[model samples]
Target: MSVHELAVTESVIAAISMQLPDSQVAVVHLEIGRLSGVMPDAVRFCFELAGEGTCVEGARLDITEPEGTGSCASCGTSFPARDALAVCPCGSADVTISGGAELTIKAVEVTDDV
Candidate 1:
């Protein structure tokens, strides 16, 4: 288990636990971009253990990974980027990348028993 992912999952669980102190969390929706420097698999692996005994325990974790978008400064063309160093089809090296590197909690679902 990666310590980074474990710590991140712990924090996420703690936040959910604090918000829904008495509720049983049913799901957690998250967005993790491809270039976010975070490994989705690692986060998934850490979720269960990190959420143990908390509101997030046993909750389903859903993650979405947005692809990297890049815009070429030279050609003004926007395209998908496989990596930070992606070159534009126009052969432009001056590219600005975005839509990758996202780590956010989009939503949370809880049981009515709370």
Candidate 2:
């Protein structure tokens, strides 16, 4: 896995640990967009390593990848944006990517403290 993913995972664990210091994390819900530049697989691979000895250890890593969306400025058309440079149906290159490119932690599930 990339070091970037490891850093991201560490940050995630740090945030969760800070939020629910007394609880046992059961799951980590993540939303990784296609344009986000963060790989879901890399995060998954690094989760366990990052969460070692932390509350998030052994926690389930839930990731969701949202497809990128773009809007055409010339024709006012909205379409899927698989890449940064997207073309519009009207043969216009003036497209604005609206959605995707998000790496969010939607929710965190925790188990009851013993």
Q: Which tens-of-lDDT digit does each residue in 1-114 have in candidate 1?
A: 999988888888888888878899999999988987889999999998888888888889999999989999999999998887889999989999977877899999997875
Clash number for every model?
Answer: 1, 1
In terms of lDDT, the best-performing candidate is 2
**Which residue pairs in candidate 1 collide?**
36-101
In angstroms, give how far residue 30 of model 2 lies from its true place. Answer: 0.2
Runs of candidate 1 exceeding 4 Å displacement: none
- Residue 75 displacement (Å), model 2: 0.9
- Per-residue error at 48 for model 1, in Å? 0.2
For the record, the alpha-carbon RMSD of candidate 1 to the native fold, in angstroms, is: 1.5
Tell me the deviation in Å of residue 40 in model 1: 1.1
Which pairs clash inside model 2? 36-101
